[model samples]
Target: MANAASGMAVHDDCKLKFLELKAKRTYRFIVFKIEEKQKQVIVEKLGEPTKSYEDFTASLPADECRYAVYDFDFVTEENCQKSRIFSLPGLPTLQE
Candidate 1:
């Protein structure tokens, strides 16, 4: 697959890993910024039944969703981690 921004070739293994990660809900740190907000909010994934990047991207409000997926290329191997997905403050959980 190609890098969405640079149009450079991304390794097939990397692409497959990305898809696998998405399927496993292993990617955390979904960051976003609201209007006039200088700092980005990083939403850590909480638990199983984790939302896929595609589902999250499609469900986000148009006004706030700038990035569809977090760029893992910038993350170091040591920093790769997972978290339980939680409902943001004031938001209802899927069970609700």
Candidate 2:
């Protein structure tokens, strides 16, 4: 998501990515909340590092089969950027 990308943005990585939590497991995260109200994020890739935040629905798209459940430890965006999400052994190396 733009929030995730910009909030914890790396100077050279792609704005959006399908991250692998484990082998045969990939997921994506869009901005679910921001401050007082629900918001979505917008990133101007070519123009700036990232900018703009907007609103999004409170509900996730379970009907679309586009999501999965995983427990994540909430951390500041800065902390998230510096940490590795999963270990090397659990990384997605083979595309299935």
Candidate 3:
């Protein structure tokens, strides 16, 4: 599928990986990049289930923009097991 506003298409692999992450918990995180040459969004990296959040942060380029999805798992106050998928889009900047 293509984004009308950006005129960019999302690669099939990108969609497949996201589904796997959400449905199967196949990866801890998935990083996506916009390949200008291909005019499409592509999967750049897949973080293993054992990878930490710090590892995911380290995978991002300092100067470039990226799209990422992270599987965050936690125990609720009542001790219920829960998981949520987080979408991190665009450049993340540090405020002084």
Q: Pick the candidate with the highest TM-score.
A: 3
Model 3 gets an lDDT of: 0.83
TM-score of every candidate relative to the true structure: 0.25, 0.19, 0.88
> Which of the predicted structures, 2 or 3, would earn the higher lDDT when compared with the native?
3
Task: Please list the residue runs of candidate 3 whose C-alpha ends up more than 4 Å from where it truly belongs after superposition.
Answer: 1-4, 90-96
Which segments of candidate 1 are over 4 A away from where they belong?
Answer: 1-29, 34-49, 68-96
The RMSD (Cα, Å) of candidate 1 is 15.4
Candidate 1 weakest ten by summed lDDT: 87-96
Score candidate 3 by TM-score against the native.
0.88
Give each model's clash number.
7, 2, 0
lDDT (Cα, tens digit) per residue for candidate 1, span 1-96: 333233333333433433444566555423322222423223323222344556555556667443224423234578966443333332221112
Q: After superposition, how far is residue 57 of candidate 1 from its true place, in Å?
A: 2.0
lDDT score for residue 69 of model 3: 90
- Candidates 1 and 3 compared: the better one by lDDT is 3
Report the error of model 1 at residue 96, Å: 39
- Candidate 2 lDDT over residue span 1-96, tens digit each: 233433532211222332332322333222221232333322212111122121112233334322212223346867763222332122122112
TM-score of 1: 0.25
Model 2 pairs in collision = 39-55, 40-54
Tell how far residue 93 is off in model 3, in angstroms: 24
- Residue 12 local lDDT, model 2: 19
